[model samples]
Target: MAVNQTQSSLVIPDNNASVSGNPGPWTEPTFTLAAKVRVGVTCCFFLIASCSNVAVLCSISGKRCKSHLRVLILSLSVADLLVTFLVMPLDSLWNVMVQWYAGELSCKVLNFGKLFAMYSAALVLVVISLDRHWAILYPLSFTSAGQRNRIMLWTAWITSLLLASPQLFLFRLRTAPGVNFTQCATHGSFTQHWQETAYNMFTFCTLFVTPLVVMIVCYTRILWEIGKQMKHKNELARSKNDLISKARLKTLKMTLVIVASFMVCWTPYYLLGLWYWFQPEMINQTPEYLNHSLFLFGLLHTCTDPLVYGLYTPSFKEDLRSWIRRISSILSRRAKNSKQLAISELNIKDLTSMEGPTSTAVTMQSVF
Candidate 1:
């Protein structure tokens, strides 16, 4: 029940950098008045996001469930974790420095990884939504572990990579006339205008719009099925079937919340990106601060997913708490040992000082 999927549309292609082909003497207002503070805040959120998602992965690893839902949950957690590790730090650095210091290949790889993570997260959630739809509607015919389900998971990754492949080719280092430093930009040509537009449209539809529609439809069907099942609930006693019904309802609600969170977090960024796609001049008119704000909002989804997991999944909470306690215990023991070591050394020094030159034998056991 460790359901998690947070896809950010902010890391799409960074067209803002690309759009500035011919530079002028323009002042880019750093998003927040205190740019350092904003950078610190973003970095803190990314760190929290990284830690929480890694904890989710640890929790998942501690369990052994062969259910297809479990597999999907693992996939989603891994995708989100990758976003935290691979994308968030670079995002923070870019926000603060406002330049691509890591060079061309890194820029391409960074963009590719970000897009890959976003697409994979979206695809996994869509598949999970569909899986739940089938499970609820065709209970008798449904099984979590199937060869088809494995194929579907594989296809999801393959398709995400294919969709994200453009990032690897399109993004590279570029320089504007006035800028001294290079920036990571998607190179756009006059002939590739339609191609760029088409690709952006495809990414938006496939990663955000289509997934939202599918999840909404699937959850709608799931709700209808749950309502129908409830009508027959009185005929059966409080048994396994009843428990399953309750569990299904709980899961449906959890998934709805997760989906809602994803929508709220990414919609602004994606919508703004789409607007930028068609009306490139609008970018020049838009406040520099607003773009960063939208990107930060979308970035928040990475941290929010782990919180959603803790709220919805009791088992995940327990496992995560257990892992935290284990880490705390290890730290505690190390601290204690260090303390004892210091005390023992001090006692030995005290004994040597007290008992004069030949006092090598000290009661270290007593000190301990």
Candidate 2:
């Protein structure tokens, strides 16, 4: 999902890790500008995304943050956080070293994590959109925030893990006859050709296309519902008031922003993958820079959730501000206390100095 060779739609390293082994002359991979840029971008994103996703997790896990949308966001942030921590650093390493020195087990685990996080994030988005669709269009049927069952969240994680389990088997450290180091990759063979193609199609449709379709449909229906409700003069006051609530509108906007960011960040990687599936030759022809750039774009989505939600949702914004203020207060208090202690110490020193030998002698004599 990020920039891992295993996650790439091409399933083939554009240059370094050859699919069919050593074709003829084998030369060591040299570091290039694309590698440098990919490493730098990945490192930057790893820091930003890891911190933001963690902050979102902290913000939403609080008692005050109870809501269906917040719960969904909590789940989504978990997935993004996993991607940021588990997938990003290794992907960045692969981008730079252009070799997989890690053993077969490491390869399987890393690839599984990448696929699991990606699928889980996408599926969670679909679930959120569906929840919104149900809540917005049929207010009567939707459960209250406290009443919402966590079954769907559990199901998303389990389902994503089940779907991505193939990576454990398909991924292994592969080394060409003449190559010194092994790379984590699937075998590009006649037997495995169909398997790779089918898996790629499944991942693309499940993780990208289907979720996108679900989001679009849900959002469209939601808008239609809102518009229809607004037009009905005889609509129940409660319904009208619900629609007009600032919190509701903010939630909707936040949802749209999250969906839009996901689409923007992921679409290119999926589209490029789709193209590569049809035109395997293009894999060789596609510029390495473009491939790295697309992966970077996809990775950017991992960091954007908090920003999107914070900007559009007042509650999250307020929570963030409160968290910041609390931290500032603690720091300020510590500084003030330290300053007071310093002043007290200085005053004590001045008093002792002023007392001089006379005071010291009197005090010692009295004590004796």
lDDT of each: 0.70, 0.73
Please provide, for model 2 over 8-105, each residue's C-alpha lDDT reduced to its tens digit, 9 standing for 90 to 100. 42233332234334443445555578778888989999999988888878777776654666678888888888888877887777766677777879
Model 2 scores worst on lDDT over the 10 consecutive residues at 1-10
Q: List RMSD in Å for every model shown.
A: 5.1, 4.5
Instruction: Look at candidate 2 and give me any clashing residue pairs.
Output: none
Which ten residues in a row are the worst by lDDT in model 1?
1-10
Q: Pick the candidate with the highest lDDT.
A: 2
* Cand. 1 Cα-lDDT: 0.70
For candidate 2, report its TM-score: 0.82
**Which runs in model 1 stand beyond 4 Å of their true positions?**
1-38, 64-66, 144-146, 189-192, 231-238, 361-368
Native-to-model Cα distance after best TM-score fit, residue 297 in candidate 1, in Å? 1.7
Question: In candidate 1, how many Å is residue 269 off?
Answer: 1.2
